[model samples]
Target: MHLVDIHDEFTHFMANMTCLSVMSVRYSSRCILAKKLRDCDRYTNIINYFELMYCDLKVRNESKEIGVLCLFVLIYFLFFCVVFICINEYYLPALKIAAIRLKLNEYLAGVLLVGVANSTSDFMLNFSAVRSGSPTMNLAMSNALTSICVMGGTIYVIMPFKINSASVFRDFLFVIFLLQLIRFFIQTDSPTYWVKGLIILLIYPIYLAVNIIDFLLMRYNIRKLRREIEILRYKRSSPMLDKKLYDKVTTLKDLEVDDDFKILRMKTRYGIFRAGVFVTPKPLVEPRKVDVESNRVLFHNKNNPKNRFLFTEFIQDLNPIDPEHWMFSGKYGRAALICVSPAMFLLRLAIPMVNYEQIKHGWSKLLNCIQIITNPFLVAILLETAYFTTHNNSWLINIYFDKALWSLAVTVPLSLIVFVDTRTDIPPPYHKLFSIFTIVTVVTLIWICSWEMEVIISIIGSVFNQSSNYMTVTFNAFSNAVPDMIAYIQLSKNGYGKMAFGGIVGGIVFDITINLGAQFARSNSESRHLLGDFGETIYIFLLLTVFSTSWMCLVLDFNARRSGGIFLWCLYVMFFIYVTLIEANVIHDFTADTVIEVKD
Candidate 1:
């Protein structure tokens, strides 16, 4: 029975083994088939290698691009920051330092340094206008107005914040404010020359005195430091002199034995010491010699006798022959002129959205017949109506009438001359007369218009003790309207393409003037209420405006004729409006808060 059971177990084991082997073989075959299918359907090795290479290349390219872009951005940012810092801090401060060192008064230094810097912009604008054949009156008016706007606007914006007074009145009462007021009064016609001279001259002396005081203080501090050093030296002693006799004797020559020489020993309660005395040979000393002939002998190098003469000749040659060269070569003078003149031209040309390129294109051609007959006259009429409605003073009225007559006279002659000149290739004998008439007319018109605007605004403020916001808005609108009219006139006179840019200047002027004016007016009352605490926000804007205006003026003056009267008048109107807004706000605040209740 046991043999039968063992045989059955062995048979069962053999059967199970056979089944397992067959299953294993089938599984192996399926694995091989699957591998073959994958190989046939896709090029896995090639695809994987290509993908890896592509990824590597992509990463490399991406990193390089990013690095280059980052580097460029960093460089540009640093360049701009450096330029700004140098101009605002280093260059400006250096001038101030030089002025102080020279013992110039603060005002004089300011006039000489800052004024020249500032006026460069004006000069450039004026010069450009003259070059472009713009009427002198217009150029003058524009410069004056731009100056007033920059100064008054800056004060109006900054004073309120600094003083923490919401009232424009209190802000206006500051020293600068008072000075400006005084200046305004003094600017009247027929002012004594001595008064003007005194005012102008005193500025420099004040600047000089302050700087001198600073120099003295600095010198005192330096002397104090020297004294401290001397005191420190007195507290210490030299160790080299404290050595024993034996230690001090470095060589056998330092000691000598003579018949009377002796060694001595001494004993004390705390110590005993033995000493040897030695005398050395006499010290070697050189005899002093005085040469009487040395002083009389002119030491000249035989090989280089021509050196001195050559140097002298070089210096003489280098000396500037012309005064202009000397002035232009100076760092301050050149910097002031270069920086300021371009700035002024830029300022004049900068309207909102308008740049130098656009301005250049607009004024290239002279005004045409249609422009002369329609657009400018219409603009003049509208401007006059706006002025009359807001300000009704006799002086202003007369000025307005004068402006009208001048415009009409100038426009007609200019139109006729241009038409005749263009039609006939050669000017007639009376062309000179026509040209004179046109020039006179334009100049007179611009001057009258500017004077009228100023006088009218002043009269309105004086009588009403308020600014005409409505008129200010109208003036801004008119600025835009005039440009549109000019564009249309240009189209009529010289076709669309010729005067393509004529409209651009007007558009920019309108937007900037109106928006800026509105902002000033709105801020005037509020800013005054919070005086003596405003941050750099207001001043920064002022500075930017000044810079831009200066640049514009310079560029424009170089490129085109500009009407100073018109520019100045526009600026005057804006200033008047700003002042009024500030004053009114102050008055209102004062009256509203007449009584205050305190609670503990």
Candidate 2:
């Protein structure tokens, strides 16, 4: 070979190596950066999400009542649609994806994440109500039932889903008893309601305990069944075995194993434990070989035709950097994106997402610099979380659980950011150590979104002059239930009806217990009437619904058939309409005790 040719080939090899090195760095940087957040499509196309909702606005100086019909319901509903999509599509799904990474069962994931995380927003409203010395438990309790009806009830209409009869039955019984107890408390108007609430709150841990026990017993029964099968196999094969014994073994082999635990034997696996069965990830932590993607929910829907609508598909899959789904793909989309780029950039800065985002090396570097300089609040939050969750045994990691170590926290993350190379595409965001904070990061986003929801509700209520009860029952119920319904809809869509339904019930139980308890504990209302004039109508209707649900479950022998689901869903809609009419004064407000006497 010629010397010139050999030298040229060597040069070419070195160039290839350099390019590969650059690519490798970019990939790792993106992954570590992902630990910074759980990103969603909402981060992109910010204008598309917010634009149409405001296009109908007309500034009016008068005609508030007329405005209520056009502006309040229609415009506010658009706003609701946007927020609902955000929560159902991104926030809750992100939490579920995290659970999947941890390899937890779907039912358990729903109960734990959906049950507790929802309180982020609810507590804010409850806190506001308590600060005003208002009775807050009514809203929380009613919202629980509404959430179940909206989520669990709707699942039946979609498909005939058999529930884990024992677990669901236990949950329903707890809710039934608890609901009745709440009714009594409302009737009495006890000042020691806080104590009662505290007592209820304490039951949550016990509920969790029961759930864990039930899960263990379930595992044990699976083992027991397998053992019986093994014994039967041994008896069938044994030459010395008696004919009668072999015949009995053959008969026992016909025993069934149900995944949903529908049969009486399966349902009664841990009968004693059954009595107590009422209850109830980063972006991801995966092997180095597997690509770590946080938008598992988005990708999973790609192939499912049912999950897609041809019109909204683009919005659903929007990833700004990904050319395939980029808004810049079309002329109008490009123009719109450019127009809203500034707003979108600010929103991105406020809520950064990391995992699997194809952020360019150059832009990633620039963004790091820009965000650190412009958004010091983000820095402060990152620093604060790092300080507390340091995972180090050092005393410097404060035990006080307060911001006293703010200075230290600031210094540590700031110094670490430099070494973490948050500036460059390859070197920055290589902070794999910070991956643990992804939960905190996603949670912060959920919390911010939730707080924003409270603001939205407050704004709408102030405009309409709706009574607090009406606001809590209708707006609060719809807001809380919508996200939950969307979540359970996903579960049921995937044929995890049992898991979906279990989660709905468990979530309601959580709301009624932990959430309701908090409300009661915080409440200082002097009002003798907890139920406003017709508030008892909702409670009464909910009780009847619960009784009907119980009867439906029994008739089907715990099978959640479509017939039962549609019936319950229809019932819920009727209930919602009835309540709405009462609020509108179209129906009789039967209780004279409806209005709480207020101190001026």
Best by lDDT: 2
* Displacement of the residue 487 alpha carbon in candidate 2, Å: 2.8
| Candidate 1 structure lDDT | 0.30
User: What residue runs in model 2 are displaced by over 4 Å at the alpha carbon?
Assistant: 1-60, 63-94, 97-103, 129-134, 186-194, 237-322, 326-466, 494-496, 523-529, 557-561, 584-600
On the 0 to 100 scale, the lDDT of residue 164 in model 2 is 57
TM-score for predicted model 1 compared with the true structure: 0.20
Writing each residue's lDDT as its tens digit, candidate 2 over 368-457 gives 333333344553554454333331222122223244345454645665555344323242334322222333433444443443354346
For model 1, the run of ten residues with the poorest summed lDDT: 257-266
- Decoy 2 TM-score against native: 0.60
Clashing pairs in 2: 34-354, 34-355, 421-428, 422-428, 532-594, 533-594
